[model samples]
Target: MLGSFRRRGCTCKKKRCTCGSMWYYRYDVTDPVTGKRKQKEAGGFATKPEAEEAAKNILAKLQNGTFIEEKDISFVAFTEQWKSIYEKSGKVKISTVDIRKAKLKIILKHFKEIKIKDITKLKYQEMLNSLFDKYAWKTICSVHETAGLIFRKAVELEVIATDITKGATVPKKQQTVEDLENGTEIPKYMEKEQLAKFLEIAQLFGNANDYPVFLTLAYTGLRGGELTALKWRDIDFKEQTISVTKTFYKKKEVKRTYILQPPKSKESKRIIDVDDKDKLVINTLRAHQAAQKVHDLKGDGNVFVNISQIKGQHLTTDDLSRRMKILLKLAELPSELTPHSLRHTHTSLCAEAGVSIDQIMQRLGHKDDQVTRNIYLHITKTRKKEASQKFADLMKSL
Candidate 1:
C-alpha cells in the first residue's frame, strides 16, 4: 500500500522551501518472515505529483520481487549477498566461482567501503585502466566481468538503478610482432608423428604407471582431470572402453588440493573406445598396481597416482604438466607441449583420418562441434601448399 500527502506548511514547486509545506509518501512493506506490515515513509518532495510518482514506483517494485532496502549498504556487503546467490544458483563451475572470488579481491581493495550506487562508469573504467599497466588485457577483462556481474545483480535486486559497466571500454589484447609476422598460431596438438615418437620413448622407460597414463590420455582424449579421476572399475577390458564419470579439478587458495567432481558437461560423461594394445597396457598397469600393493592407497579407486611420492595420492594437474615436460625432454619433443596436447593431437588425428567433426566431438567428449573443429582448423604451411597445388592442377586441366 502506498499513500502520499502534502505537508501542512506551504510549498508546491515554489523552488524555495522557506514556506514549510512539502509532499510526503508512505508505503507498507511486509516483513518476509513475520506476518506483520512495516511502514516506511519518506518526505521532502517539493510537489505532490513528485511524491505520488515516487510512491507509484515503490509500489511497483513491491508488487514485483525486486524490492530490497539496500540503498545504504556498502559495496562489499552487497557483494557478499551477490556471492551467496551466485553460489546457490549453481550456474557455474566451482573452479569458475573460485576464480571470480579471487578476482573480486582486487576490486574490493578499491571499492570495499563505497556504496554500490556511487560507483560510476568512470570510476570503474579508471579501476580497470589502472590494472592495464601491470596486467594483461585478459586479466583486466576478467576483473571487469566480475565487477559487472556484481553491479548487474545489484540492479536486478533494485539496489541500484543502472549498470555502470555498460559504457566502460575494455580493450582487446594486441597481437605480438611474431604472431603477425609468421602468421603463427598456437599448435592445437602434438602432431600425430610426434605423439607416436613420444609414446614410443615413454614405453621404453617401462614405468608401470606413467607409461599407461600417457597411453590412456592419447587413446581416449580424456582431460587431465578426467584421467586422474579414473578408477579400475571405470574401464571395461572386454569392451575396450573407458567410462568417464567423474573429473578432478585443482583448488589453490590457502593450500593446494585436488577435488573430484562430476565431469565438466553431460557430453564429458562418455565411454571412449580403445584399441587392443591400449587395453593390454591398461592390464599391465592393473598388474603393476597389484605387484606394488597399491590397493592400500588406491582404495578410493583413483586410477593415476604418483607411486614415487610417499603419500601415493592421486596425480595433480600440475604434477602431470611437470612430468610431461620431463617426457618431452626424453622424447626430444617441443618443450611447449603439455598433457592437454594429447587431446588436441587426438582431435587432429581424427580430423586427418576423415572422421566427421561430430564424431570427433563425441570422441573428445566435447559438447560443441565448434570446439572440436576450431582446434583442428589451423592451416599449416604444408596444408597451404597442398591446397595451392590442387588448385593449380584444376586450373591446368581447364
Candidate 2:
C-alpha cells in the first residue's frame, strides 16, 4: 500500500464503522505461502497525514520483506519471554544469567513500556550513555549484550522488522594520566623481579595457604576462580600437569555466597605444565594441608584450603585478594596489584623467557592468541629496553 492511497468513510448502515472522524486504508493481497486472498487495513488514523505516515511505514516494511501485521508487543513482554527462553536453554552460566538480569534493569528502566519494534540503535546508544557514568565498562557491555540478545530473539520471532542494536556502541571511559599515575588504570600483572620478591616474602611471612595459591597462579597462569576451585584429582604428579576442569564463581545474590562452576570458557579447561620448582611447592603445600587437617569437612578433595584459623575451609577469591593485599603491604610491593595480576605476571615472565605465543596461549587457557600476543609484545619490548640500558651501563664500566 502506498501513502498516496485515498482514504474513504465507512458506508455501513448501522454504527458498524464510525469513520466520520477517522480515515482508514484498505487493500487486498494474496498470501505468499498459502495463496489465500487477505484484506489488510490501516485504521484509527485521525487525519490524512497520520494515515499517510502509517501507510508509508507499512509500505516500507512490505517492500523490505519485514511486513508483519501482528499486534505490536510491548518491550516488557518480549524481554520477559526472551529471558525465560534464554535462561532455560542452559547455554549460559547461572552466574551469567544473574548478572545479566541485574544489568537488564538499567535497560528496563527506560524501555519497559515502549514497543519492541520501535527500539532503535539511537535509543540503545542513549541507554548506554545514560549508564556509562554510573557503571563500569564491563557492566555496560553486559547490558548491551543482554539487550542485543533480546532484540535478536524478537527479530527471529518476526516480532520486529529490524535489529536496532547492530551499530550501537558501549562507550569506554578514556584513561587519563592521573588514572595511570594513581594505578587506577587497567589491571596489570607484576614484573618478574617484583613477583619474585613478593613470592619470597609471602613464603616467609604470609599465611600457609597464600604461598601455594600464589605459586600456582604465578606458575600456571590459572584464573583466580580456577585456582580456588582446584581439586586434588586435577593434579598429576607424574605427568607434571594440572587439569583445569572447573572454577569457583562468586554469586552476587543475597541467598547465595558462591558456587563451584565449570571453567569460564572451553579453552579454560586445559592442563597446565608444572615445573620442578612448582612441584616442590605443591608437595610442601600438600604436606602442610595434611598436617593441618584442612580438608576435614567431608574430606572434599579440593587442593587449596584456608588457613587453620578458618578451619581450612575452601578459600573464596575475595579471601585470596585480601590475603594478597596484606602480603603486598608486608613485602613492600605495589598495593595496586591483585591476585589476578599473578596470571598476567606469569604470561609476561613466559614471554620474557622466549616462550612461543601459541604455547603461552595454551598454558594460560586462552581461546585466542591475540590478547596473549599483545601482552607478550608489551612485556618483551619493555624488557628489551631494560636490557639495552644494562648493556650501556656495562660498557660505561668497561
Tell me, by TM-score, which candidate is best: 2
Candidate 2 wrongly placed segments (more than 4 Å): 1-57, 60-66, 129-140, 169-186, 292-294, 308-312, 369-374, 382-398
What are the models' TM-scores? 0.72, 0.75
lDDT of 1 by residue, 1-398 (tens): 87546565664576556665656777888887997998866555657787787677777888996676547678999999999999889787787789899989999988998877657565687788788777788788899899889999888888976687887987666788887897635455787788889888878864556677787788768899998888878977677678999888788863548778888888898988775654665676666557645534746666666666545677777877877888889988889888888888878777676667788788788878555666656523356678999999999998
What would the per-residue lDDT of candidate 2 be over residues 38-59, giving only the tens digit for each residue?
7766555556676677677777
Question: In angstroms, how far off is 378's CA in candidate 2?
Answer: 2.7
Q: Give the deviation of candidate 1 from the true structure as CA RMSD.
A: 7.5
For all candidates in order, the CA lDDT equals 0.77, 0.77
Candidate 1 yields a Cα-based lDDT of 0.77
Residue 48, model 1, lDDT: 74
Model 2: clashing residue pairs?
A: none
